[model samples]
Target: MAESDSDSGNLAQVRHVVLVLSGKGGVGKSTMTTELALALRHAGKKVGILDVDLCGPSIPRMLSVGRPEVHQCDGGWVPIYTDSEQTLALMSIGFMLENPDDAVVWRGPKKTALIGQFVTDVAWGELDVLLVDTPPGTSDEHLAVVEKLKKKHHVDGAVLITTPQAVSTGDVRREITFCKKTGIRILGIVENMSGFVCPHCSECSNIFSQGGGEELAKLTASPFLGRVPLDPQLATSLEQGQDFVRLFPHSATYSSITTITQTLLRSLEAA
Candidate 1:
C-alpha cells in the first residue's frame, strides 16, 4: 500500500472529506474549491484544502500565500494558514518547489507517492471539512487519492465541475463514470461559466450554450447544485488573489456561489 492502512488516526479530526473534480482542465475545479472553502469559512465552518494537482498547484497562489515554508511537527506537516482567524488552511506542492514557474515533470509513480504522502501527512487538526482539488482527467493521481483516502480517512463524496457546453458535459460524463466505478458518491454537479455577467449593468448574457450541465445532471440522476456566471470582477479578484466572496457581496456570481454552498451543505446534512 502506498499509505499505511493502519495509520487512519491521522485524519481522525477531519469530519468530512470532499473532492472537487473535473474531466477536462480549465473547467474551474480549483476555482470552485477556493470559492467554496471561502464560503464555508464565511458560514463559520473550519475548512482545509488539499491541492493534489501536483502538475499545476495553483491553490497556493489562488489563496494569496505565495510559496510559504511548510513546517513539520510530531503529527505531520503543518498546513499553511490563509487567514488571521485560521479558519482556512491549505497544503500544496507549490510550497516545496524552488520556483513557482517550474513544472513538475515526474513519472506516474512519483506523483502517486507524493499524493499518498499528502493524504497521510497533513496535520489538519480539527476541521469541519477538507476539500481536495484534483488534477484534470481520471489518471494515476486520482486512483492514488481514492485508494489512500478510502483506506485511511473516509471520502464523503465528490463535487463535479463542468462548463455549459456539450463538449464539457460529455467529458464530465466520464468523470461521473469514474466516480461510479470507484464507488465515490456524486454529491452534485455545478455549471460554471454558464453565462457572462456584465460588470456595469449586472445583466447576464449567454456567451456559450447553456443548460448542458443541468441537463446532464438530470439525465444522470444527479443533483444540480447551481450555475455560476462568469463575472469579470470575480476573475480579477481571483487573479489578484483577493477574496471576491467578501469584497463583492452584491455581485450575481457571489449569490450563485452562496446558493451552491447552501445546497451542498443541505446535501451533506441529509446524507
Candidate 2:
C-alpha cells in the first residue's frame, strides 16, 4: 500500500478539512477559527478544530476547555469534546503546555514535527469539517500542515482572514501567494473587524479602513466570503465562551457570521 493510503486511516472518517489562515497576528485569526467552528456546530455538523498555533494556542481559553488532559486510545489521541452532545471537538498544543503563560520557544523542525503529529494522530471521527487554526504568516508551520494534509488527507480549501487595513490585507496577499504556491485552493477571503457598530444607535463606523479584503479578493479572482464587523457583544460572547451565534441571533455580527457560514457551506456543497 502507498504511504498516503496507510496514513489515511487516521482521518478516513473526516469529510472536509478547512484551514483558517491570516497574514499577521492580532487580527482575530484564532477568534475567527473558534467562531466558525461554533457556527458550523450550530449548523448541525460534527466539527473538529486542530489548533496548530503551537506558540500561542488560545483556542482552549476561547472555548472554555481549560487545560483538559489529553489521553491516547488504541486508535490515537482522543480530542476533547467541547459540548455535551460531542458534536464539537478540539485538540490544541495549549492542553499539552505545562504553563499557558510560558512562551513556546522552539525551532522550525520541532514545530513541523508537532504539526505532522497533529495532522495524523488525532482521532477526528466522522467530522463534517475540521478547521485547522494556523499561526500568522506563511511560515514553516503552514507548509508542514499543507504538505501533511495534502499528502495524507484532503484539504478542502483555505479561508483566509484579514482586517480592513491595508497593512493586514497586504500581508494576506502574501498568504494568497503562499496558498497558490502550495496548490491549496483559496475558498474565500473574510474581512474581519471591518467596522465597528454602535450599540446605541446601531450605526457602523469605519474606525479602520474598509473594503481592502474585498478588493484583494477581486484582484486575485477569489471568492469574497463576507465582512465581520467589530461588535462588543460578539467579543464578550467569545471571551465568556458563550454561543453568540445562537444567543444573539438578531445582532449584526451574528447575521454576518451566519451569512459567511452559509456561503462557506454552499461552496463546500458545490465542490
CA-only RMSD, every prediction: 2.3, 1.7
- Model 2 spans with C-alpha error above 4 angstroms: 1-6
Give lDDT tens digits, candidate 2, residues 156-176. 899999999999999999999
User: In candidate 1, what are the lDDT values of residues 1-271, reduced to their tens digit?
Assistant: 1234346766878878899999999998999999999999998999999999999998888889988899999989999999988999999999999988999999999999999989889988889889999999999999999999988877889999999999999999999999999999999999999999988898999999799999999999999999999989988888899999999998889999999999888887777
lDDT of each: 0.92, 0.91
lDDT of 1: 0.92
Score residue 6 of candidate 2 by CA lDDT.
57
lDDT of 2: 0.91
TM-score of each: 0.97, 0.97
Q: Give candidate 1 misplaced runs (Cα > 4 Å).
A: 1-7
